[model samples]
Target: MSGLIGKKIGMTSIYSAEGTVAKQIPCTLIQAGPCVVTQVKTTKNDGYEAIQVGFDDKKEKNTPKPLQGHFNKANTTPKRKLVEFQFNKDVELGQEITVGDVFEEGDFVDVVGTSKGKGFQGVVKRHGFHGVGGATHGQHNRQRHPGSIGAASYPARVFKGLKMAGRTGNKRVKIQNLRIVKIYPEQNLILVSGSVPGAKNSYVIIEK
Candidate 1:
C-alpha cells in the first residue's frame, strides 16, 4: 500500500450532513505531503519493491554529509523525515507526491505516530486501576494506588509484563481505519475522522 508522511495540525469539529441529519463530527487535521521521492528500490537490487519518500525540509548545515549526497542524488533539498512505502504505481526520483494525488474523501487510512509523553504516571491513569481503599473510614492514602501486584509467598518478585505505575505514552501507535472526512489540495491539508496519535506538528505516517 502507498503512504505519505504528514504532520498533525491539531483537531477540530466539523458538521457533516448525513442524509437529513446534520451530525457534528470530531476530526483531526493533518498537513500531508508534497513529499519528494528520494529513492526507489527494486526486487533485483534491494530484494524488495518500495519507494523511499522524504517529507518536510531540513537545514542543509544540520544534514550529514552522506545524507546531503543522498538528497543531492534525488535533486531535492534535505528532508526531516524519510519513509519507505510499497507503491503500486510507477514512481521516479524527485517526483513530488501531494495529498490530492494520493487520497480522496471517504477513504479509510491508517495513521502511525509517536504518542504524547506523560512521564511517570500512576496506576489510575496508566492502567486504570480502581482505588485500593474506600473513600470512607479514614482510608484516604491508598486511593490511587495499585492494590496488590501478585502473591507474596509463591511469587517472590514481581512478574514480567505486570501492569504497574511507571512511564506512560511516548510510544509508536497506529490508529487504523480512520475515514477521510475532507481534503484541501491547495492547502495540503486532510481531515480524518477521530483523534490521531502524537502532539501538534508531530510527524505521522498516513497509509492507505
Candidate 2:
C-alpha cells in the first residue's frame, strides 16, 4: 500500500452541500507530503517492497553521522523524519511525492499515529471499571480500588496480565477507513472527515 507521511495541522468544521440544506461536518486538517524518496528496497536486495521517503528539514549539525551519509546519497537536505512506505509501484530515487499524487477527494484512507499520552491512570479511567463500592453503604475508602484481584490461596500467587491501573495512552493507533473530505494541492493540505489519533502537529501516515 502506498501512503504519505503528514502532520496533523488541526481540526475544523465545514458545511456539506448535500440536499437542500447544508450540514456541518467535522474535519481534521493535515499537511501532507512533498516527500522525497530517499531509498528503495527490493525483494532481492532488502527482502521487501518498500520505498523510504524523507520529509521536514533538519540542521546538518543535528543529524546523525550515518544518516547524514544516507541523505547525502539521496541528494537532499537533512530530514527530520524518514519513513518507509510499502508501495507496489516503482519510484526513482530522489523522486518527490505530493499529496495530489496519491490521494484525492472522496478517497478512503487509514491513518496511523501515536495516541496522546495520559500518564498514570486508575482502573476507572483506564479500563472503564466502576468504583469498588459506593461512598455510602458503610464503605470507607475502598472506592476506586481494584478489589480482590486474585484468590487468597487458589494459586498462591497473583495472576499475570491483570488489568490493573498503570500508564495509559501513548501507543500506536490506526483509524481505518477515514474518508478524504477535501484536498488542497496548492497549499499541500488534506482534510479528512472525523478525528484521527495523536495530538495536533504530530505526524500520521495516511494509507490506502
Which TM-score value belongs to model 1? 0.96
**For this target, which candidate reaches the highest lDDT against the unseen true structure?**
1
What local lDDT does model 1 show for residue 29?
99
What's the CA error at residue 141 for candidate 1, in Å? 1.0
How high is the lDDT of residue 165 in model 1?
84
**Which lDDT tens digits does candidate 1 get at residues 20-128?**
9999999999999989999999999999999999999999999999999999999999999999998988989999999998998999999999999999999999988
lDDT of candidate model 2 versus the reference: 0.91
TM per candidate comes to 0.96, 0.94
Q: Give lDDT: candidate 1, residue 139.
A: 68
Top candidate (TM-score): 1
Where model 2 places Cα greater than 4 Å from the true spot, the runs are: none
